[model samples]
Every structure is written in structure tokens, then in C-alpha cells.
Target chain A: MNYISASPALLPARAGVGFKPEHFGAIAADQQPLGFFEVHAENYMGAGGVPHAQLRFLRERYALSLHGVGLSIGSPEPLDRDHLARLRRLCALYQPESFSEHLAWSSHGGVYFNDLLPLPYTEETLAVVAAHVDETQTALGRRILIENPATYVRFSQSDIPETEFLTELTQRTGCGLLLDLNNVFVSARNHGESALGYLASFPLIAVGEIHLAGFFDASEAGAPLLIDSHGAQVADEVISLFEWTIEQAGPLPTLIEWDNDVPDWPLLLAEAMKAQDRLRHAERGYARRLDRRAL
Target chain B: MTSVMSGVAGDFAAALRDPLVTPPAMLSAHAAPAASTRFCVYRNNVAVSLIGALEARFPATRRLVGDEFFRAMARLYIKAQPPRSPLMMRYGDELPGFIARFEPAAEIVYLADIARLEAARTRAYHAADAEPLELSSLAALDPENFARLRLAPHPSLEIVESAFPIVTIWASCTGEAPLTAVEDWRCETALVARPRLEVEVRRAPPGAAAFLEALARGMSFGEAADSAAARAKDFDLALIIASLIGGGLLVPADGVKQMETIHGYLA
Candidate 1:
């Protein structure tokens, strides 16, 4: 099932803010050249209210994407049918340009843990995640994007590399990857690997979107630990890694996520501007490469 | 594969409920060095995030009980009552009821009510929207018919009557204050309403609480008046009607055709 917008959003490589209620009035009253606004699908789960009212007003002018944080896609349990139904309803109502979820589980047993928990990249877990993704795609009757998660620790029993696991997921389910370069940098640093290597190995052909967000460096002793908190500006190193990804994957619809202690709209847009610059640079580079090939 | 997934889900539930089951690994015999640590990270994240949800939803309660005891109680409550919905904002709706029966906080008798007020405020903040009736509609009605007409409160209106002075405690705890001492000897009533988009809570008068409570149940003006009278025979209908309308409680009755030139001797 391929999800395509009837009138697709013109996601220019420009700055955008995480659509929040705090900035609703500011966005509504002001005329800012924001690229697009992103919202968490679950936050607007309610039937009708001020949030919906605000979103309805904003949707007319802004290109919207529904990013989900707690779908528990990698859980071994059966997908929550009702939750998926609500998601489908949201998709039907908004007709958002893009939708994505993390390649992590937040629930075990019948209880939800609320945080995106990591999963071991064994064949067994891969098969489990693939089935869930298949079911989710079938339920929504549309293709969705999967994001890689940042982990504080790695499992010794895992067999496949994270990139290989993600590639296999896309190959089996035909869903695209919403690669977060920050998460790659975060997970690689914590687990002792090269972010560049991870970027090189990523299945660029299956990449649908890119995410650039801030991370916290919880480095202790001599080791530098990167935590994907999404609570600050995009780090310089992460941007460098993101540039490498764009050099490989070209210009994809990228997002700037700042969920905690969120700054004012202008500040967020400034950070997004930085991403837009990198994307434009990548696009120009791609154009030059094509021109050189013709010559 | 489905069966294996189900088995994992079962183990995951056990890991959250039974703290003794530390690692969430599928097989114990093949446990890796990273498995235990990763599982611990997952456990800590779950415990902390869920507890944070509870704290955000029930800040007054947390303030009352302090941090250490609050975290301990939150952990126990989370295991017993994991959220039934994916909507994180609605996660801790049952915390008030849980706090009421919580053995550790049994000594703080008012803690449960404070939690209830906080939860009510949260619900009111997210309740469905409705257009309020114009105040002129009420003024046009003849005072005699005011008692007979039905009054419809806003959908988000909630009246909570508690034995504890929850409003004063919540106000003090939320604001910087030379803390007003609540004479915990008497019961207090708090009325919550979303006049605009935000929820507002105010202390309700003795008879006013009864009047609004009855009206919230879809009672006619007369019935609500009688109910209020039963609670306090000296309940002044005029005062309540004026106050309720001023607070955006009643809406105009449909097809209330005004009679032009009532009993005019000569037009």
C-alpha cells in the first residue's frame, strides 16, 4: 500500500517549527516563511476540540506531517487495532503529506512503557517487526516511514547490524526509512562505531525522509555518550553527518524536532534554517554531479 | 512467530509489574552482558517517564507529598494501573482514585482531593468546545418564568464537592504565598468551568454548589432550585441565577419566542 497525497505538500528545504499550542497564536497571526509544521498524531487523538480547531486553521496554509512517537512498532505483541484505526482516521481527516514512526517498541506485555525502547537486531525480532509493519500498512491502507532509534546500550545477543535490519524491513514491507542522522550519531557514539560508516551503509534508495534534531552528550569518564533528547539546537557534528547523508541520499523531506524546553518560534525556525541551508547545498552538489557526468 | 511475540509481550508485562523480573530478555539462559544493562535502561525510562506523566497531571499532589515518597507511590500505582490509552495526556486520570486508597498517603487525608482537583483541571483543559449563550438572552426572560425554564451548563462544566479545602491548598501550592492556612475542619466546594479555552476553578458557595450540581445533571431551573432549597432552604434563587449566568453556565432555550407588547391596554 503506497500512501500518496492527492495534492502533495511542497516541502521546500526551509525552516519550520514543531506545531505546538504555545505557538498557535503566533503562527496564526504572523506571516513567517516556515517550510512546514509537524505534529504528533497522538496529541490530536481527541475527536474535536481547540487543538483540532487550531490544526484545522493551520492546515490550510502549512504543509503538515504526522509524526508518531508511541506506536510500539517493534513490539512482539499484536498491533493495537484501535490505535491504528484512530491513526487511519487522522490520516483520512488531515491527508498529511507524510507520516512516520520510530523503529522501536514502547510496550511490553499489555502495558505501555511510554518511552521508545530499543530492540535487539536478531532475525526473530526482524520478522516480528516486519509483520507488525505489514499489518500497520494494511490497516492504514498506505505506506508509512520507519525511523531508527537512539540507544543508551546495545544487546550482545543481536545478530544483524542496525542498518541491515532497517534495510531488510524496507525490502520486506516496502516502507521507506525516515532516517534521523542525530540518532545515528547518538547510537554509534554510545555503542562505539562510526556515524559516517552508518551513513554510508544506509539504504538510500529506501530513504523517504531525514530528521535532524539536537542530542545531549552524557559522556562520562573518557567516553562521550550521545543521548537523542531532541531538546536543543541541531549539533554541529550532527549537521556534518547529515551533510554526508544528503551527499549519499540527496534532498529528502527533512524535519527539525525539538520536543523539550521548546524555544520560541523564531528560534526553532532559525535552527530549521540551518537544515534548509544544508539541504540546498546538497541539492546544488547533486546538480553539479549530474552536470559533470553530462560533460 | 506470533506465539513467540505473545510470549515476549507476557514477559514484558511481568518485567513492569514484578520488579524482581529485572531483565526483559526473551531467554534467560542466553543472556548477554548488554542485555541486562539495556533492560535496566528500558525499565528506568519507563518508570521515570510514566512517573513524570503522573507528576505533570498531578503536580499539587506531588507538591504535597514531596519527591521521594511521590516517586515511590507513582511507581506502585503505575504497575497496578498502566494507562489504557495511547493518549499520554489522559494517562493519569485514575490517579486521584488511586491516591484515595493509597496506604502510604492514608495519613494525608486531603491528598486524594487535591489530586482530584488537579485531574479535573486537566480534563477541563482538554474538554470539547461549545459556544456560550449571549447574556442578553437571559435578561429578556421574564423573572417569573426564569424558575420554570431549563438551564444548560457548558459541556466542560464540572462541580466537585470535597470534604477537604482542596482549592485553597491547590492555590497555595501552585502560587508563591505566605501560605493561607486551610481550617481543614470544614468541607469546601470547587466549581470548574471552561468559560473560554482555559479551565477556571473558583470556590463555590454552599447553596451555589447544589444549584450548579443539579443543573449539570440536566435538571430544569425549577428542579435545580428545589434541590438547592432542600440542601439550604434559605437558598436565594435570584443570586444563584445571576451568578451562574455571569459565569457562562446557562444557554438560551431554543424557540423562546418573546411576546411583544404583553397585555398592552392600547397599542
Candidate 2:
């Protein structure tokens, strides 16, 4: 099934925030300045209820994005056909501008761990992940953005840099990247690598969207590890990294994710406004470049 | 193929639940020997988040037991049976049954019933929406025909029949009412349903559960009411119908469901 919306089915190059039910009444009352609203696809998969009701209301006003966290696209097993069908139904009904999932696996052997577990970036995993992505794109009949996972451990499996692995997967499957800046900083700092170096190697041109969120510092560990706990505000370093990526990529559809310790409406809106500031700054740079080209 | 893929992913999964099993050789936490938080982080997120989902679903149950006691018991439940559904909202289907057998929570005899009430409410919140049977439709029916007509229960209708006053406990825990001692220590049946947007829960009248159960089993209104009245002499038919309308428990009549008895199916 396909749906053609009045607006283009693509995320605008502006800031968005994840939709939470608590802010439903607030968003309904005031027409906030936001590019889009993203919802975890699994949470709204029920047959009918307030979730559907609220999502329908949001879909009418905002450019919605169905962000999936449970597709398990990185798993070695075949994608859950039932889950893929549900995603298809959701996309058809909501007509979201964009849909995305993680580069990590959350389920294996019929048990879902509810966490984005890491994978070894070997030649074998690359093939498995690419094949899964191909199937997912085929199932949805549209491209998806795969977000990079924040990890505390590095796999000793085969020789493959994370950037090269992601680049090859995008090339093989013709999908886009989510480029979570917090994840890049978290994974790189944990492994004693440079976030700038990782971004330089990242496939920036194919980024359809970007994710900016906060992390918890497990500084007490043997080596510093940052947990991708989206509880607090976006860190200064991550906001800085997001600015750099916006400079390079020219303000893609950025989303502020405050899933944990979800703040009051004003706090969440403030977080989105923070990203909007960076995007507006990048927008000016793009317009200046275009004017220069016209000259 | 399963084994090949499982070789790495499977080993990693096995280690998540069991801390004794170290992170597979495929992982290196900063090249440190015998020291790292890699595996622990994943384990912690899985446990904490799953427990959090449980806590969200069974808040009244959690409030009844203190946070410390709830978390400790929830931890045991998580270890024994991790969620089968990827959807977190549907994660704790087996929890009420789990609580029924738990020794530590055994003393709070009504704890399991409260868990059941909460679980049913969660299901009702997500249950399929249907237009409820209008009260006028039933009033129009002839008294003779009304006895034979069977009403279809609403898709979201669920009843928790308990020996304790669990509805009061749940209402108190959820702040719907202040905590108060139950003057009557009689059995109670709680009906949970979502006819429209809101999910409503309240005490079901005497004999309503049996009547509804029989009605659900495809018994005619007359037969079900007869059984209920015979079992409970104080059964009031008007009150039962009123409760059904108020709770949106039944939709308009369709074909009467085929009755299934103990021995065989009845047409």
C-alpha cells in the first residue's frame, strides 16, 4: 500500500522532537515551531486507543517520522515478517515523512533484549546487515535511515572500521544514515578515537537525518564509557559536534531525543529550539553559498 | 545459517542475561584484561528498561509494594522470563501469574489480583475500538425475544473476579480515592473496558461476572441470567444491564456465538 501526502514525504531540513503523550495537550494548544515529530513505531502499534488518537492529531499538523527501535535489522536472522508488515501498515496509515532504526541488533534467537546490542563489524556481519537492509527497504518500498549505536565495547572479530562498514552497507542497499552525534562521541571517546576523525570518514552526503541526544558518563569504569541514556539535555560537546555536522551536511532534518527523564513541555521545546538555533545558523551559510553561486 | 549467525549474536545474547558468561571473545573493552563495563552496560539497560516497562504497566501494584520490594521482585521475574514480544507495552502478560506464585509477595493475598486488574487495564487501553451497543436497541426488543438474544461482549471487556476487594485497593493506590479500610470483606469482581477513548474500571455487581462469563460462552440472556440468579439469590437483572451499559461492556447483537460446553460444542 502507498500513500501520497499533500506535502512531500521527506523530512524538512529543520529541527524536530520525539513525540511523547504528556505533551499532547500542550502541542495541541499551541502550534509550536517544529519541523516534525517522531514516534517509536512499536509503541503505537496497538489496534486502537489514545495512542492512535494522539498520533492522528499530530500527523494532521506536523511532518511526522516513524522512528522504529525494534526492527532488529542488524540481526543475523531473517527480519520478522510480521513486524515488517506492521511497519508497512503504520507507514501507510501515518504517511510519515521519514522512518529510521538503529544499526545495532536488539533481538536474537526469538528473545528481544530491549537494548541496542553491539555487533562485530566483520565481512560476515556486513553481508548479513546489508541483506537485512535490502529486505527492509524492499518491505517498505522506500529507503530508511540507520542510526549509529553508542557502544562501550569494541569487537575483536574481523578487521573493519565502523565508518567503512556503514558506508559499504549504504552503498549496497541504497539507504541513508541517521548520524547520531552523541553516539559518535560516545563510541569514539570510549575507544580512544576522535569523533572528528570518525565524522570525516562518515558518509555525510547520504545522511537523510541526524539525532542529537544526551549520554550518562560512567567515568568510574576502567576506561571512560558513556551510556546513551537520553535522560538529560544535549551535552555541549554533542551540540558542538552537531553544529560541525550541520556545517558539513547543510542542516539535515535534526531531531532532539529526550526519551528518558522526559522533561516538561517547555524543557523539551527548549531542547528542540537549541537544535533549531544551529540549523538556522547553517541555513544562512547555505543561502550565502547559493548566492555566491548565482554571482 | 541460524547457527552461523547465532555463533556471534547468539553468544553475545547468552552473556547478556547471565553475567557469569563474560563478553564473547568478539568484544574488547579497551583491550583491558578482566576489567570492563561493556557487557554490564547492555545488561543494565536491558534489565532497567524492561523493569521500567513493567513498573509503568503495573504502577498500582508497584505502589502497593514499596519500590525496593517491587524492584527486587521484578528483577526475579525478569530473570526467569524475559519479554517475548518486542513491543514493550505487551511485555508483562505472564506477570500476574508470576506474582501469584511468588513466595515473598504471597502474604499480600490481594497483590496478584491487583496485578491482574492493572494488566487488564493495560490491555483495554490498547484493545481494538468498537462502537458500543446503544441502550435504546435493547429497550426496543420485545421481552420474549430479549430472553433469547445474545449480546456480543465488547472487544475490550475484561473482568477480574477476586476474593478480595482489589478494586478499592487499586483505586486507592492510583489516587482515585484515599486509602481506607474495607468494611466488607466480601468477594468482588472488577470490570475494565474502553468503549471509546477512556478506559474505565469499577466494581461489578453481584452475579455479574458469572452472567457475563456465561454470556461470553454464548449462553442466551435468559439462560445466563437464570444461572446467575440461581447461584446468587440477590442477582438484580436491571442492575447488571445498567452496569454493562455504563461500562460499555457489550456491543450490538450479531449472530449468537456457538455455545461450547464441557462435553462438546453446541450450535
Candidate 3:
């Protein structure tokens, strides 16, 4: 399927937030419209309940994105058909505008670790990830946005840079990218690399959505290491990096994620509102650039 | 090719679960195995997140045992048996059984039952939605044929019977009741179901679980009532049925299935 043109129309180039059940009342009653709301697909995988009821209500109001956290897309083992089938069923039920999963695996040796475990970025690993993406896209009959992972370790066998690996996967599977700017900042800081340099090399045009979130500070062997905790407010550094990304990518569908210590609606909304301010600035800049080109 | 990839992935997986296992030789930071502490990030994430999933599902159990004790217990459980699938909402399905056999938890006789009750609530919350069987349908049934009617159990209904006062313990710890000593040591039965948006965990009298179980097995009302009466000498059929209706614990029939002759209906 031609994923880019598929409707309820692509997610608007505005700010969005990850859906938290606690914020359902506020989100449903709010007067201001959001660009979209992203939900972890696995949370609503059960047959029926309030999760679905709430999602259904939200679907009627705003664009929806089904984010898959358990596809285990980087596994060497065959793709889990049962999981793919569940995703298909969910898509049929909700008809979400977008679907995305991580560029990491969670299951191995017949066990799901429940963490987005990192993998080697080599040709062998690349083939495995590409095949998984192919199977998912074919199974769901829609292009998926594969998010760059927040990693603490890199493989010695990985000859490919993270950007090139992601770009190749998009090329092979016709998948789009979901650039998580906070993840970029986290991974870069952890690995002693420049976040700006990583984004400079990244294939920005293929990015369909963006994520910004908070990280906890930690260290390894007395060197600074950051954990993608997603349990707190977006860091000032991450927000700055996000602003830079919008300056280049020009107001994509950005999301504010606070999954763990999720604040009250007002606090979370303020985070999205902050991203919206930056996105609105980028939107106007793009408009002015268009007028200049016409002149 | 697949086996080699699996071997590589297996080593990575093993290291994440076991702090003892050496970090995989192929993994590093700045191109050296010196980043084993960095490797601990993935390890820590897996352990903390899985334990967090369990704690969320078993809040009452966590409360009965303080947060520290529960987490330490959960960590041991995770190490012994990590989740086999990614359907994490119900990941700790075997936790109750594990706690039952666990040596440390042996003295807390009711801890395992609390886990089971909490697990049942998780199931009830996610179970398929259904409407309550209307009272009018029961009222309209022919007197002779009513006893022969087979009611479908609501998908979310779960009956947990225990020798310990699990209902009181759960209610007290989960904010429905203030913490109080349970002076009366006795058996308890909890009817856990989400007939509507909210999951209701109600205490039931003796023989209620058996009655509901019999009904759930597709037995006729007469048979279920007989089973309940046999189990509990003082079983009141009216009271149990009233509780069932009040909780919307049975799926509403299709406008009440048309009944045949009395003998035919019983058959």
C-alpha cells in the first residue's frame, strides 16, 4: 500500500503527546486540538475493555498513531506471525493514521526480555531487521515508521553507522523513519559522539514523525551515561536539540513522551505546548521561505 | 546462518539477565569491552521494567509486603523466570503459583492468594465487555422452565475462593478500606468482574464461588443451586442470584432465548 497518501490524512505538522490513561479525561475534554495521540499498541491488544473504549473515543476526536513496542523487529528468529496478526486486527479496528516500532529486539531464546535490546548494526543484522520490516509492512499493508533506538552499547562487529543502517532499512522495506531527537541526544552523549553530527548524517527527508522525552543521568566507569528513562520532563538539552531538528526538518509531527512518572495533564500539556511553539516557528519560517522562492 | 545469529543474540540475552555472565565479547563502548558497566544499562532496564510491570499488576500484594520486599521478591522471580512473551499486561500470570511454592513467602499464608486475586483483577479489567442480563428476562421466564435455563457467564467474571480473608486484605490495602487488623480468621471468596467500566471486587458468602463455578460450567440453574446447597448447607439461592444480577456477572441473553416445552427445555 502507498502509506504516505493513506488517510485520515497524515498526522498534521503540529505537536502531539503520547496517550496516558490518566490523562484521558483531560484530553477528551480539552478545547484545543492536538496534532495526534500515540498509544502503545500492546496495551490495547486484549480482546476488549476501557483501553479500547478510550482509544475509540480519542480516535473520533484526533488522528491516532499505533506504536508497537514488542514486534521484536531485530530478532534473528522469524517474525512472530501471531503478533503481526494482532497488529493487523488492531489496525482494522482503529484504522490509525500511523504505526511505528523500534529498531531493536525484545525477544530471544523463546523469552521476551521486555526491553528494547540493542543489536549489532552489521550487514547480517541489517538483513535480519530489513526482513522483519518487510514482513510487518506486508502483514499490516501499510508502511511503518521505525524509530531509532536509545542505546548504551555498540557492537564491535557493526561496520555501519546508525544513520546509514536506518536509511538502508527504509530503502529496502519502503519504511519511513520516526526520529526520536531525545534518543539521538541520549545515544550520542552515551557513546561520546556529537548529537548534531549524528543528525547531520541522518536522512532527514524520510522522517515521518519525531519524539522528544526525558532521560535520567547515570554513569559507567566514571564516564557519563544517560538512560532513556522516559519518566520525567523533557531535558533542556533535548528541547534545544529538538528545536534544532525542527529548524532543519521543518515542523514534523512531534510527540512529548512521559511514560513513567507521567505528570498531571497540565504539566504534560505544557511540554507539548513547548514543542508546539517551536513547531509553529518552523512552520512560519517554511512559509516565508516558500514566498521568497515564489518571488 | 540462522543458528549463528541466534547464538549471537542468545549471548546478548543471557548477559542482560545474568549479572554474572560476561558481557558479550562483540559489544562495547568506544570499541572496547571496558564498557561492561555501560552494558549494565540494558540489564538494569530489563530488570527494573519487568519488576515495575509486576508491581503495577500486583499492587495489593506489593502493599502487604513493603515495596522493598516485594521488589526484591520480584527481582528473584524475574531472574528465575523472565516473561516468555511481550504481552506484558498479564506477564506475571505464574507469580501467584511461584509465591505459593517460594520458601521465603511460606510464612505469609495469604500472600499467594493475594497475588492470585490481583492477577484475576488484571484479567477482569482486560476481559471482553458485555451487558448485564436484564432482570426482566428472568422475571418473564416460565416458572417451570426457569430452573432449566442456562445463563452464559460474563467473560470478565472470576471467582477466587481462599482459606484466608483475601477479600478483606485486598480491600484494606487497595484503598477501599483503611488498614485494620483481621481479628476473625476465616475463609473468604471474592467475585472479581468488570461488568462495566470499573472492576468490582466483592466479598461473597460461603458456597458462592461453587455456585458461580457450576453456573459457568453451563449447568442449569437447578443444578448449580443444588451444587451450592450441597457444598454449603445454609446456601441461599435467592441471595447468590441477586448478587449475580447486581454485579452484572452474566452476559445478557439474546432477548432471552425462546423456550420450548418444560420437558424439552430441561433436556
Candidate 4:
């Protein structure tokens, strides 16, 4: 049975925020002018109760995006068919406007680590990720987006760059990219790479959505190490990068993700407004470019 | 995948579990002065996230044990038993047993039972939804057939019996009573069920646990009453049945074709 009201065909190319339980009552009481709200798909896999109830209410009112964290799409082991089936069932129930998962692995050898563990970008890894994405898209009967992961260490034996790996996956499986700008910044800083340089090589045309979140900065032996903690507000550097990304890509569905230490509703809404402002700025810039071309 | 890549993944996992094990040597040392310090980031993430899951699942237990004790204990448990499933909601099922065997927590004898109750509540919150059988649904049944009536328990129904007053302790953690104020400590049975949207945890009356447990195992109503009566001399069958119906603990048994028809009609 259809669980949500008829929603738009795609999430509006505007600003959204990660859905947290604390804000459920507030969001329900007053509909914020949000583009959409995103939730971790695993949180709603439960058979019944508040999570589903709140999700149903939100799905009826606003556009919804089901972003998954536990798909383990980059694992060496065969895809977990049971987990995939559950995800398929959820997608059928909600029919979310967008479904996305990370380009990282969480489960290996049947043990699931809670963190999004990084993987080496290699030909073998690419083949595995592409096949998994293909399987996921086929099972769900919709194209999925794969987000880049924040990494701490790189593999010495890896041959392919992160952008190349994502591009190859998109080409092979026809999947889109969920460009997490914060993760790009975090991984670049953590690995001593230039964030802008990474963005220059990134296949922005394939980006279907954008994620901006906060990171924690710690020094390991005096070198800056950025962790994707998602505990605080989006950093200035990340926001600047987001603006540049929107300038390049001409506005996509952007999300402000504050999963840990979630703020009060007004604070969260303000963050979304920031993203919305950037999106509108991009729109205006794109309009001016078109006007120039016409001139 | 290449053996080298697989080996690196395996070693990385091992190092995360055990801090003493050095990070896999294949890690490219581009950013940090020491790869080990960088590797600690993943280790910290795994520990903190798993601990957070446990904390959410067993808030009362964590409160009773204090934050430092809980975190240290949770870290040990994480090392010994990581989650086998990607579902975070179902991550801490093994925690109660681990706490039971944990040496440091031996002083708090009732802690494990409290954890069990919390876990049961978590499970009930996520269990499948079902429309409960109303008390009036049984009106059409003949008095003679009442003895043979087989009742089904709700999908979320869970009975947790403990030697310590786990219900009072759990309730105390929620501010119903202070922990030190629990003077009369006695064995308690908790009936956790999600009759509707909100999961309710109530103290089951004397002998009610036995009655529900028997019925949950497919015993006839008369047989379950007898079992409960045998366990507690004060077992009042009528009162227990009313409580069960009120709490939405009992459903129409699938084995009874007539009951299914009746349930359909009620629906």
C-alpha cells in the first residue's frame, strides 16, 4: 500500500535539512518552507511506530529523500540481499523523491561497524561498487545517488583517484552523484590534498544532490585532521566551497546535515536558510549568464 | 578484489578492534606525521557510534552505571562483540548478556535485568503493527467454548521476569521515584507491549506473567488460567483477562478459523 501522499517527481533544486526526531513535533505543527527533508533509510526500516508515523506525516506534507548509510555498497563481500530487500520495501512504501547511499563500506565479513569506513579507489573496488549500485538501482526500480566518503588515510596500492572512481561508477551503473561538499573538504584536509583541486577534477555534471555538514578539526602531530562529526554548524570554508559548487553546477538539491548534537528547530532552519540563500544566488548568477548570452 | 586490498581491509578492522595492533602498513602516509594517530580516528568513530547506540537503547542502565563506567564497559563489549547487522536499532541485543557476565558490573545484580527490559522495549517499539482484539469480540462465544479458546499474543508483547524489582528500578530512572527511595525491593514482572503507537511497560500482576507466557506458547485459555493459578494462589482469571484485553496483549488465535472470521468481521 502507498504510505505517503503523492509528492513531486523530483526534489526541488533548493535547500533541505536532515530530518531529526526532536524537530518532528515542530515540523508537524508548522510547515517550514523547506525544499525537502532527508532521513537515514535504516532509521525507518523498523516495522512500525514513531519513526514510521513521523515519516508518514512528513512524507505527506513535504518532499522526502531516503539517504542510506548501511548499504555497504563498497564492501568486498557479496551484497546483503536481505538488507537490499528491506530497502526496496521502504522505497516502495515511501516512494521518496531521491534515494542515496555513501561510497563507503560499513559492513565487512558480516560485522557492521557503525562508521562509514573508507576504501581504496582501485579497478577492483570500482567493479564491486558499480555492480552493487546496479543491483541496488534494479532492486529499487530507480536510479540511486552515491555520495563520496570522508577519509583519514589513503591506500598506498590504490591507483584510481576518488573522483575517477565516482565517475567510473556513474558511467558503468548510470547512477548519479550526491556530492557531499563537507566530505570533500574534510577528506582533502585530512589527506593533505587541495579541496578546490579535487572539486575541479570532480564530475559535477553527474551531481544530483549536495550535502553540507559540520566537521571537527583536530591536530595529529601538528597536522590538521578534519573529522565529519556532523555535530556543529556548517563551517565557513565548507560554505564557500558549497557556493562555488553551486556556481559551477547551477544549483542542485542542497541539504544541511546536523545529525549529532542536533540544534533547536530555529537554528536548524537558519542553516537551511543559508543553503537556500546560496541556491538563490546561484539561480541569479545563472540567469545573468543567460542574459549575457542573449545580449 | 586483490588479496592485498582484502588483507588491508581485514587488518584495518582488526586494528580498530584492538588499539595495540599497529595500522596496516599499506596505508599511504601523506597527511599525518604518524599513521597510527590517523588510524585512531576510525577507531574513535567506531567506539563512539556503538556506544551512542547502546546509550540510546539503555538510557536507564547508563544512568545507573554512570557515564564513565558505561563508556568503559561499552568499549569492552564493543571489542568483544561488534554488531552483526547494519540495523542500528537491533545493535545492542547482546548487551544484556554481556553485562550479566561482566565482572565490573557484578555489584549491581539487577543491572542486567534492567538492560533486558530496555532491550525488550526497544524491540516492542519496532515490532510489526496489528489491530488488537477488542473485549466485545468475545461476546458472541458460548460459555462452554471459552475453556477451549486459544488466544494469540500481540506481536510486540514481551514479559520480562526478574528476581529484583526491575520495574521499579526502571521507573525510578524515569523520575517516578528516586533510586535510593526504592525501599521495598522484591521480584517484579514487566509486561512490555506496543498495543498502539506508544509502547507501554507495566508491572504485570501476580501470576499474570505465567498466564501470558502460557498463552503465548499456544496454550488454551483454561490451561493458561490453570497455569497462572498454580503459580499464584491469588491469581484472579477474570481480572487478568481484563487486564490483557485492556493492554491489547491478546489477539485472536490463527488456529481458530472461527476467531479469524470474527476478527475480520470486527475489522
TM-score of chain A of each: 0.93, 0.95, 0.95, 0.95
Off by over 4 Å in 4: A1-9, A291-295, B136-150, B220-223, B254-267
- lDDT score, candidate 1, position B154: 64
Score chain B of candidate 1 by TM-score.
Answer: 0.84
Q: Candidates' DockQ values?
A: 0.24, 0.44, 0.43, 0.48
Q: For candidate 3 chain A, which ten residues in a row score worst on lDDT? A: A1-10
RMSD of each: 6.9, 4.6, 4.6, 4.4
Report the TM-score of candidate 3, chain B only: 0.89
Whichever of 1 and 3 has more DockQ, that candidate is 3
Q: What is the TM-score of chain B alone in each candidate?
A: 0.84, 0.89, 0.89, 0.89
| Shift of residue B84 alpha carbon in model 1, Å | 2.7
Best candidate (score: lDDT): 4
Candidate 2 per-residue C-alpha lDDT over A221-245 given as tens digits, one digit per residue, 9 for 90 to 100? 4556778898889999998898888
* TM-scores of the candidates in the order shown: 0.87, 0.93, 0.93, 0.92
Report the C-alpha displacement of residue B135, candidate 1, in angstroms. 2.3
Score residue B62 of candidate 1 by CA lDDT: 91
DockQ of 1: 0.24
* Per-residue accuracy of model 3 over B1-267 as CA lDDT, tens digit each: 565466668999989888899988877787432578778878888888899899999999998889998999999899888898778987999999999998987888999999999999999888777777866767877866878877766778888889999999999999998888988778888889988889889888667878878877778878888988999877987787778875688764432232111112110
Show the colliding residue pairs in model 4. Answer: none
Shift in Å, residue B225, candidate 1: 2.3
Model 1 per-residue lDDT tens digits across residues B244-264: 777775554331112112111
